[model samples]
Target: MNNTDHTTATVEPAIRLESVTKQYVGAETVTALADVDLPVYGGEFLAIVGPSGSGKSTMLNLLGLLDGPTEGVVRLGGRDVTDLSETELTDARREYIGFVFQDFHLLPTLTAVENVTLPTAFTDGQYADRAVDLLGRVGLGDRLDHTPDELSGGQKQRVAIARALINRPEILLADEPTGNLDRETGVTILEEVRRICERGVAVVAVTHDELVTEYADRTVRLVDGRLGEGDDGFAT
Candidate 1:
């Protein structure tokens, strides 16, 4: 097996957040996440559930390392990441994390395969080939030449999922990934995500739909910027 495979095998939790807080300075000010602590183990599927303005998206952004915490620390594979320099953090994000958004975020002009292999821009040789294999696995082999506009919503989302898998990320952070799909399409996407988790990639998703929760092995609820207990959608 490759060294990357070996490394992932040895890791404990893929992601861990300790007393994380995020604040926004819009209009006046707002606290999005308040001292939230979470741990996501490798090879597990986790769901973050809440209503609008419940800090679900904020937590996903934090997990993706797209935004830094206003307080506390975030650790990936047991290493603290909050204090890294911007460049270091950027490198870490590229090497360790993958993201899928509700919008599918594909370039309008790029072919589906090109979109899936976009990570090659930051990575090198072998990973580029790996991206191609990922696209095939997502059942997009015949749609490789099609652009986002030419594909159906489900197809586009499949390409996005393959793109997220290109980096071989230990943790997959998806934010409302099925929000734009119809019920049947949403279930298809969730099943694909569940397949990824079954292959040992940790999948962390933030979703409000109750149907989606059935795919998660564990569900953590957030409310008013705080972590809550059980399924009532309130953070303690």
Candidate 2:
């Protein structure tokens, strides 16, 4: 590679894994990730594809700060956060990372706006206005008062996207974001996510569906706890 290109490539990423490995110790020990190095940049959407038991969830957990690697470094905004205290980690998670789940995870009783504002309870700032603004951005402005049960699957996922952005997170970690939706709805949700990535949030989604990769700027596959280049248009 040219030196200038290499230099530009060194720009700090939103989140990175440096030789990360994860293990679970039970009656038998299982290794889930092995020496994986990945750097996901701002304004980029990355798709992680894998089969069952392939450690895709483990990688997502480490990136979301819900769990730490058994070995190696996880950098957020170019800083090593592997050794932060639980309280510090919580603070970092609140300030820097956002998450979306397959099941839409919205509290049943909260209205759309209320659900979007849920993350505000953990931090100091007020975000009621911001939450409404986000709902609008996700095209949910008219549905602000609706509860999860009152919304369609696509609308519910839209609300979840709004909720993930309420805190103005730097990176969004989505696990099977479109897993529950029908094909048409899933594509719509993927488009929404792509738009968000275009606006400069790093997005990392672990998905089983090959269609999801169509919206990703790049894709990588995980197999038996190892990482390698994935499809431009992905395959199982």
lDDT tens digits, residues 162-226, model 1?
99988778889998888888989889899999999998888998987776788888888887888
Strongest candidate by lDDT: 2
Residue 60 of model 1, lDDT score: 90
The residue ranges of model 1 lying beyond 4 angstroms of the native Cα positions read 1-11, 122-128, 232-236
Cα lDDT of model 2 by residue, 1-236, tens digit? 01123646666888999999999989999999999999998899999997888899999999999999999999998889999999999999988899999999999999998899998876544687888888888888899999999999999999999989887788999999999999999988999999889988999999988778888999998888899795553443
Whole-structure CA lDDT of model 2: 0.89
Query: TM-score, each model?
Result: 0.90, 0.93
Clashes of 1: 5
Q: Candidates' lDDT values, in order?
A: 0.84, 0.89
How much is the lDDT of residue 206 in candidate 2?
97
